[model samples]
Target chain A: MPESTFLDSTELVLNMGPQHPSTHGVLRVILKLDGEKVLGTDCVIGYLHRGVEKIAENRTYAQFNPYVDRMDYVAAISNGLGYCLAIEKLLNVEAPPRAQAVRVILTELNRIASHLVWLGTHALDIGAITPVFYCFREREEALKIFENYCGARLTTHAFRIGGLQYETYDGFEKEVLAFCDMFLPKVDEYEELLTNNRIWAGRLKHVGVLNAEECKEYGVTGPVLRAAGVKWDLRKAQPYSGYQQYDFEIPTCENGDTYDRYTVRIEEMRQSARIMRQAVEKLAAGPIMAKVPKVIKPPVGEVYVSIEAPKGELGYYVVSDGTTQPYRVRVRPPSFVNLQALGRMVAGGLVADVVAIIGTLDIVLGEVDR
Target chain B: MADEQKPAGSPSPAPSGAGGVNPKAGPAAGAPKTAPPKPAAAAPPKPPAIMAATPWDSELARDLRDRFPDQIGETSTYLGQDFLIAKPDAIISILEYLKLEADFDYLVDITAVDWPKKPERFELVYILYSFAHNRRVRVKTSIADGYRPASAVGVHLTANWLEREVYDMFGIEFAGHPDLRRILLPEEWQGFPLRKEYSIVQQDERWVRENLGIESGQ
Candidate 1:
């Protein structure tokens, strides 16, 4: 204590949320700070743990399809698609062409909806509240399509195991295409509001930079990895659910800053819209469901199927021991793995930049703690 | 039985027997509607067993086996996916070999499966994706309970939290984890929920009662 001097660096520990509002959800980050600069961050998660993987073991394959939607509620359709694809692979029967087209349209629409929520809230966290209103208003249109197709908004278990639960509604293609037409112009409106703003650029430009090498090493994925110049998307990489037929580009940025992530996600919304329009055009009338047995007793084996969720790679590794219920269903949730890079991303940044970086990561705590 | 098994394919059986009665009957008793797929006793074996995943040796698997003949066990392909079962002791070498030599740069996920009945009760699964090759491979190794497997954080930084997750959910400890207390559950919480014996509704009731002043919360 006597040797303490002004030149000697001392760190102060700050406890930021198990309930702090700025944090996305119940994420408690123990921040070691040297004045304004952050020394390191320890993310204390699991406040919303529901033991979802354990729940899968107790439920049958068809019974557990809806449970996946709760993990990433914002992108619930994407989760449903991943689970359905995994089960279908386990059963060794592909969904009919019509079902595959509808799945593509719904999942791509969910991608846009998810990115809108992220853009709105992320901008709101950084003091740009105007885009939030515009974002949600446009999001309502997409949610309307979801409601019309599946009678639910957020956690819509839209797809069943082998195929869709219901056939496409009378105007499913028309409605989804209408949403696409109405959605693209609104994306431009939100971009006009924040993309060139002075404070938006200043707060995000050089803040919390993680490069390409570090991104892969830390296993950070989705837009965060793409923003770091890694040209990787699970849709393009693995091509599940007929994504190969859809033509789109993976947007990447040289700088992996918060601003770059914002740009990457914004461009991603455009590409998703492109996919939805194409999927609508590609929608041909055919049988929806495959010849799945009354009891779905898959062989004793395993299959890993991943889809490009709105967040990142949402993978389902389903192990079947020749039973109706899966032996093990381990979800490699993107947000959970993406959240691990928080300490690395927030290290050595300003304490104030912590929220911006967390917002930039775009983590959903339900998926993180599931 | 053959007609019932191939409801759409075998139209010859419907013409041979009761063809006149089937025509006179109403829509409920149609000729093609012989019976549901269940009651026809001589149904063939499920096609999935014939298509079940088997031990496969691809060019890459053969190359890997040549390098680590003693360590590699079964290299199986299931539904177009290839996974290798490796020995627990040589996991790091195999992972490093794949990373450096085979260009499996991205460690996609790390999860563990609990097989309580087996002598090696824990099967650790590592899913690795290679960007250069545009392929993914699963590497699994089984170990006895309470065995402190070497931590993979040194080889792949992504394994830090993923391994901690497996440890938190299954109570398997890694030997060299930097901070492996608990990621999802609290420090005071007990029981690994993902283990097979742990029921779905099970929770750490003592911790809940002490912290929240409630008897139990699940």
Candidate 2:
């Protein structure tokens, strides 16, 4: 007591990840703590770096499409969609209306699937355990739809630069319609489990509150931005791949808190179903692949095309130097940008809230490190 | 079934199969026919009187050139995205102006392209998006090997990790970056992996040998 200085000596340093389950992946957060309260946080990422940008420079444009799936493994189809659309833009080729419609169907299904994983894991992180199983139980159906469309369930390289590599499977439309029918109710069930739960609301209501302006400053996007009451979904903002044709609303929540993010994502899943139904209902009679040259050599230029990926604005910046290989392919991963807000979100929150904040951010470490 | 599983190289099926929707239905009713147009500003950005002689096309670009005529280089458009080339010294100032004046608040991405043969070998790319204007512009600048590009973290906080990533991959330093440490690679790891001259297989071999103590079967 006699030796007490102005600064608190009781502040402790806590390392919260690189292996901890609550971190979502290998995201390590170095937390400066004062008892249970977090004073500062430095997120140490790159534990899962596979040198994707380097890999893109080495591989041919077509060869690199598969690797894009590895970045955001939870939403691999969305990754494929963004990559193909960017390359298509660079190559100055357009996927046909039928192909575009099919692409939207697959991507929206994947978006639902991605949000399901987020809702499940986020609720579990907040201590509501039952929702995880319920989320997965429903998520399995979306994965099955992907499996039917493409052989791979996870990391399905489901799109090509010009169009879809594989045509819609024989029962693909029926299966997607089935998923659309099944998933809408499951979202409600998940909400029922966590939306009003005392533990869930108490843990999340006021925790990790990042206002809309702070979100913009930090470059946070996707559900987190929408949660902050910004109706800035890239799909609606800059409609890519015929997203303009689909009717849907960008779900936004006030308060920018963890609960807000939760509600936003939940609404998004329902909206994704609406988009899928429209796309599948009008599943047209045409080819899935666009006509292009045998060897894909885009002109010497760069193009940045972004999509409203489930997590956020997933943009692919492709620079082609009149070569089969890309001169540079920069992936503007939403999670990577969104993760910048974590320090601001966690600064004044409790140590336990760090997990909820991390979960609320819905970061996939593969995308972060890539 | 075997035909369905065939890979991409084979002759693709014609696009006019029984797969598409009703052509007669047209696009779904009530869907917006077009995306929202670029947000209209009340008055077009006034060209800075300093560089009135310069042939700057866009209002924002002209304003940037007028403010820092020395730093502003050539401006071009690639596939609808605008590119504003800025000298290394002028990047932060130009970015600050864009953030404050032009409303390019969202710093979308920061990356670099390697050109081993060129004298100014590294072309750093900064993509910025403005929610207000609903527009995107790419700011690019080239730096010679070993030249440090000023970090945009001071102008935009999001540039912190992005600059770290560029530094990690290309081995280019950003002056004034708060934490200029390797982000994607181990601290002890040697050599920049994304440069044009760096051999991927060789780097992998060396990294595995040094870090994991195992022979990389390359």
Candidate 3:
């Protein structure tokens, strides 16, 4: 009689999102389930598509600067940094030393802020309610630093093609130092809240296991790649904007599971804080903007520039036809690439673990759809 | 075309003036003496500073030319990065060889450019990165309008979404792509948005009217 009952069970098809809170923005994953075990999954994206690449072609080089801010709104500074670097490379000029140092400081701070948002929302997704508040408390300080520098909080276009558009606020160093002093203890507080919590570990460890090889195949990067035991970080791999000057260890974990990703991000926050401290100490005093032409026109060629964004390797491929407007601008968004591994990570796992897997991926649909 | 004309235009009088100052000035003021025929051959023609050194010592370019001579067209360097122009149909084999033998295990990105005036209209660019060497090279090949380049899914699994995106934005199909649906646009959407002929001011009027219940403002 029990075997007959098992034989009679029909598989259930579940549509998880396009509006679901845990799906992380408008991502819809269709999961084929047989009694809580997932057989197949297809991720449906592009819900927030704004056609950014198409828009890039229409706008002049300078005109398109602000648009990069809307993609990966959490790490707006990183997007701006990557786009600016690509354009600067096309123009065959480098940002002044002071500007590069300031860029490194602001971008690393943005990395921390972006990761804090990820920690908060990802914890919120997995039902750990308290860490979200602690995360915001730290993230608000980082945003305050940006507001002081750029006047905009969420979508801060902090850097220009040649250098920083706005000079540092009077006490930029002091304020950043104050933040670093407060941020380290707050990181400790976050770890205490969720790092070893039995419920947190139960939900995260071994929940979604993706190995290093699978990560490579799917073009996954950032903390996920590090979590899968690959010691690859673009900051270290290809030192850009004076990352080579800072001495900080890249964190990696061997498990390639949800817990490893969590640990990797937490350690990365600590390293980011370390880099910020070193940057502030070595922050030279000089001009912020370089000798850039007023009418920004890059030569006729194509260049791809990538930076170590908080989520992963954020690359901007710019093709110029000796014109003010780019012939083509392609953004290799980390969230979009990492989202490719969702199906691989979720297969054969319980339906309930799907939320944990999605949170582990830490996708911002703004970047995915852009 | 532009590069060849530059040297021809600039270097004509350099050898003549130098020789005129030393030996050939005997005929210089007199018209026929201005031509420094002997020194021109004696100088052996020094290359311009820009072309003095082959910017990137790209071993991959050499290997590609050696292995698949027919597929490799020309390798050019811009800003110290090598761009290998490959034959359109030979993209799959070139990429596979690079991935397997050359240790370019990572597919960083795949994108395309639209040249409206050119006969081979679409420029498909494949950006590949080698972890072992910590180097990046771009493989570029051109295709005409509506021609499908071979899919790179067989070379890199990450190409699945990238090829779909290329197809969605540029309307240049990937011949062997498993799922080549419109990625960023609706399935019922009309035209490729990234083409030079495609203006951003234009939109699918019917879809906009039906889906959002609003006029597209023309």
Candidate 4:
């Protein structure tokens, strides 16, 4: 080896996106690169910051339910469930059995839909176009159930404080069962298309490996943590919204690489289908709403309620001042926290792998920049 | 005691200031008190139910108190969830103790609540989860306006952006943060958006005008 000169080994600064097709949203990552290998990355977010926490302080508890859906717009039901559960816990009331069952079914379906979107876009990011089409076809079936039940497709305010806002529509359970039966086989079909294909595995395998310790250090959760063989799923760790009743397995992998994360997500979709089927069978005949007050003023208290969303542990920290409006509402969006580890995962990797790493993280800009 | 003081302190001028009822019309005004106030309502105002429900003698609370005397202020529960209030200076040490000894390894979130009227204006909350114990606990500390609490980055790397976000939202900085710039807002933004006085509609108008070269719509 010869002595290196300053001009021979210089780093170049490249701006990826404030608005680019592959970024999925307006996430601008400034990259410092030596040729193609990335040295460092700095994310410039907040293009979509709507000051949602500030808005929650002004809105009443019941009035603020819709805003939570807009945060993680892909998994709208999980967001709604977390917000409603936090308010319900603050009010010291439990949703009726029927309401809890319906909530579990809807949220599981939303989890499938969210992962489908992740699968489609993630594969698309790695230049696999066929899986995006196949994944969206299944995702459309899930969204159809959402639209038929709540009259909204994307940001469905499906649940109210202490219960569901709408009763299960006619043939709701039947449609959900049919979608689960149809969606599981599609998961296998996706596997056949890209799971072991040489090109797909070549791009994603051993790319952006964040181990269990690094994941715990960065507070990363969801499939990213599970793929590190942590086996820590919030639904199983701390059950809420009647999740204790459901039977499902937390799929984990040992490698903690991008490919392992993909395989873990695929297995998770199958497990979500299993949970939905069990939830529908447990749906009993009873009142869908609880005995909540019309005024909806919770006592002076605070509660932190977290749910296993598609992305990770979505938390709502609510403080009530014994008034109609809340004193403060802090949302612990998993995407925002998990996005912090992007620099850690992408550094010392090729520039092309940055897209793969971002894709595997499955971050939603709506939640990250909320 | 609270009810007796209410009738003794302000009833003299309250009745006259409230409406046109006069001294001669006392019987007409007082006739609506047929149903007496309940005994439960007669008690002094409660402090958030959490302050009353949680016993200070839990095993975990006792262990923390034994280790850090006078540093553990309140070990309270709300809806079967435990939270500890710690002295601001002892926050980092308590967090390290919880992680190393008590098995609270996961730093779930770091956020602050702004109380404009309280002498300690910023209430910092660190939500933690212990996978080994299968439990979640919150560690909180109160700080004045300009006091910077120790950053948890040394203990958990997750605190880097979480502290930056708290600083961006509430203007509560953390001491020894590696990169403590605004995470959510722009670098040149003026007021903290999550403070009590900062309304939802308010923006850094100069930031908008200078960056976009247009008047802010709001």
What is candidate 3's CA lDDT for residue A34? 78
Please list the Cα RMSD from the true structure of every candidate, rounded to 1 decimal place: 7.4, 9.5, 12.1, 9.0
* Alpha carbon deviation, residue A135, candidate 2 (Å): 0.8
TM-score of chain B of each: 0.77, 0.73, 0.73, 0.76
Q: What is the C-alpha lDDT of each candidate?
A: 0.84, 0.81, 0.83, 0.85
Please write out the lDDT profile of model 1 over residues B75-178, one tens digit for every residue: 98877898999999889998999999999988999998888999999999999999999999999999999999999999999999998998899999999988
- Please identify model 1 stretches exceeding 4 Å from their true place: A1-9, B1-51
Which clashing pairs does model 4 show? none
CAPRI category for model 1: acceptable
Model 2 interface CAPRI class: incorrect
Q: Write the per-residue lDDT of candidate 3 for residues A54-170, one digit (tens) a residue.
A: 888876676677789999999999999999999989878888888898999999899999999889989998898998899998899999999888788888877777887666889
Interface RMSD for candidate number 3?
16.4
TM-score of each: 0.91, 0.89, 0.89, 0.91
Evaluate model 1: give its lDDT.
0.84
Worst 10 residues of 4 chain A by lDDT: A1-10
Q: What is each candidate's fraction of native interface contacts (fnat)?
A: 0.45, 0.40, 0.36, 0.44
In model 4, state the lDDT of residue A324: 60
- Give the C-alpha miss distance for residue A211 in model 4, angstroms: 0.6
Ranking by lDDT: 4, 1, 3, 2
User: Per-residue alpha-carbon lDDT of model 4 for B15-59, expressed as tens digits?
Assistant: 223232112112111212232222112222444643344654578
